[model samples]
Target chain A: MSTAKISLRGVHKAFGANSVLNGIDMDIAEGTVVSLIGPSGSGKSTLLRCINLLEPIDDGEILLDGIDISLPGFDANPVRRRIGMVFQNFNLFPHMSVEDNITLSPVRTLGVNKSLARAKAVELLERFGLADKVNAFPDQLSGGQQQRVAIIRALAIEPEVLLLDEITSSLDPELVGEVLDVVRELKTSGMTLVLATHEMGFARDISDLVCVLYSGHIIEQGLPSQVFSAPQSERAQQFLERIIRAGRL
Target chain B: MGTITGRRAAYERARKRRSTVVATVSSLAVVTAIVVLVPKMPRWDRVHESFFNGERFAHSLPRLLDAFVLDIKIFAWSMPAIVVLALLVAITRNSRSAALFPLRILTIAYTDIMRGVPIILWIYLIGFGVPGLGIERPWNSPLIWGSVALVLTYASYIAEVFRAGIESVHESQRAAARSLGLSSWQTMRHVVLPQAIRRVIPPLMNDMVSLQKDVALVSLIGPIEILRQAGIDKSKFANFTPYIAAAAIFLLITIPLTRTTDWLIERERRRTTGTRIS
Candidate 1:
């Protein structure tokens, strides 16, 4: 698959002996969508965070384009600049307008000029159907709109890969579809995507590879259709059973 | 329906006017009673001959006011320095970098020592000790020393206020900024300080009120500010009216500032909580 845009080898992380990612190993091919599905506290979010270098790994290597990124003393800013992360809680800068929130990193860290950054912000806002809300403060928007703004803000950085951490889980039941629609569009445009999510239906429909994590271990991973139909491990089967009982699958 | 609503509005306006009239009359009566009764008392005969003498008030007004300008000058000179120093100290203390550990300890010690002793003591120590040491130029001028003492004294208090503001910003904001590839300093300058500084304005203004009054303390160092001028007048005329006049001028300056700060605090509370006052 043209060598992988990014690869994780022996990624281990823990918070004071409560291990989160225990010797994780995976490789993400370019332009492919990978989904990490598991029960809560099963290390899905932590793994995504480690990939972005938001959380430091205890031991292992995360190589972006065959260059080791997770090594200690490697400045994470350059690597982080190429990886965009959308948090679950929106985390839109409350003090800034929607346009400013989208353009801040581009202008500040990227050295993009004011006029171009603003133009890019305007174009993205229009693409997301948020043109009317450009000057609006984040507190003035709904949970769904805020989340969309966050995703668009991440997109503004022009990152090589996008990481989303439960982007739709915080939205209202009716508001969830709008955010997912944006993700679907991203996939159709051949953007590489990794997400930790609770949406089993969406995961099955979109992901190229689905990894089932359980208690800090990736016990099962393969094509979504195969894993959904036939989970090999007892824990994965039980996890899927819970999803079924909850009517989420 | 229009007539009824218009009539209700008129009635509300009338009621408000009546309440205002009642408040005005009550206040005027209090003033009028003091004016009439105090003059009638025997003590007024003695007090007025000395203190309320129109001629003395007229004579002292310009002289005392001229000296008061030095206090204003000291306050003006010290304000910008105080703000900049407080931000520096607060940032130093709050930094997570191990390289700043010594600076953090120093900042903590500065705040602790400056806050523990009375502000007057700092003024005394700096204003008296520095010049007594026979230092040159800025350190030697009592005027400069008084200003330096005020800035040092007030910056410590203001630094604590700033630290509280910085800490009050949610940790998630920092996380979000860093996730976007903003460095630690960039995140602080953009995402954190703007919000924190806004949150702190009311408290900072509260400290400003304290500062405005404390500028009077510089009089002890021999700058011939309002209080010192008043002291001279008291000794010359054998009356306490100069003290009262000095206090009145201080109230004129500080009371409005204190009131404005109170209003700002209320507005800040409403804005932060996303509430409407109506």
Candidate 2:
């Protein structure tokens, strides 16, 4: 059995009695793509954010590498460094160039020298097919290009796990494939990825394990082929039917 | 069809004729008014005499130069104090702690009070009140007192300028930095403050220009700056030439600075737009 890179048990989050995430329990295994598919506001993004401690869970244990992250006096920054996150809106620093954006956290947090950081940034940018646009600012890049840069930025610190929150949802139809290509490449490279996406086809193609979230609960989870081809739960079937009928799956 | 075309032509002609009549009447009226009013206006002889007279110019030059140097010294002392105080005020104003709320409120009240009161009054209060209290006036110099008054008064305004600049930084910029695993201070120092300071530069330069002009107001406390020297020369020479010469000198110093500031504002505006585009 593969080791779990991230484990969540009895995770609960409430925003002023709304109860956005209620009792989420899941395990993301190392070196595999696990896609979380759900409707909007189904706590998919919240779960991903919790793993990075961006939104602190109200009640739950987030175990990263079999160690509880919420334990007293635990350093959240190092944990955050280990768990990279790509935001839905890209969240690229507008004032910084693509190279600076990628190199920033590494230099500031890890005390990496500028020359080393720059070389690393160039390598990542080149791998991401953005070598020529290194000096360009965030606003200069297209949505797909910016999102790719954001992924490279997160990956620059050599994170053990990466969380992608609806990364392709903001991209144009034609631009979506370019971003998905990067994710596809990451999956092939044996990176542990927890992706929250509405793109059913991309999820089915790239994910090894697929989990369907409904009303803050993982209603069904299994192999991507099993979940996509034959869902046992009525909720999963209904969601898949709705998504297919809407021509989105 | 011919009649309709003729009617259109007539309408166009009438419109052109009406505009011509209006323009002609306005110019004729202005010329007539100028002709009637020219001699009734104040004589240029006073202005001419002030410029040509050597005795008055020479008498005022010494006092004007002295006053100018005094003004420069006062500004030199006050500027650093204002920059540091304003930065402190900005940080306090932006702090999230509950304890910082009262400090923020007090800062706002202080700025408001300083802006409302006259600087001359502040100078007198500092100069005379300290002597009355047996403090022996630390510097015992009007230059020092004037500078103190200027710094206190302008620091309040500068603080507001800085606070506005800091607040103008997009909230998303801060969030982006935080998400990168940077602490609050790290995000502020690295990302937010750099952008904020850039945005505030042109306005800060404007404030500096205002400060230069405001230095003259210190003459009320008897610092013997350019304005003070001009006043003394005017009285001694029994002519307004010295005052005119001082005014000329002020213009000579300020006009270039004003042009430079305008150019800077335009350049910054272009850079901001360029950044937005990219």
The number of the candidate with the highest TM-score is 1
The models' CA-based lDDT, in order, is 0.90, 0.84
Docking class of 2: acceptable
Q: Please write out the lDDT profile of model 1 over residues B1-278, one tens digit for every residue.
A: 99999999999999999999999999999999998898899787888877766666666778899999988998998999999999999989889999999999999999999889898898889988989987887559878888888898799999999999999999878878888899989999999998899888978987898888788898887888998998898888887778778888888988888788788777755543433555
Error of 2 at B202 (Å): 3.4
lDDT over C-alpha atoms for residue B197 of model 1: 91
Give TM per candidate.
0.90, 0.82
| Model 1 Cα lDDT, one tens digit per residue, A1-249 | 238988988989999979899988888999999999999999999999999898889988998998889988799887888999999998998888888899999999999998999999999989989999888888878899999999999999999999999999889999999999999999999999999999999999999999999888899999999999999999999999999999998
lDDT at position B163, candidate 2: 88
Q: Give model 1's TM-score versus the native structure.
A: 0.90
Q: What does candidate 2's lDDT look like per residue over A129-149, in tens digits?
A: 899988887777889999999
Residue pairs that clash (backbone atoms under 3 angstroms), model 1: none
At residue A37, give the lDDT of candidate 1. Answer: 98
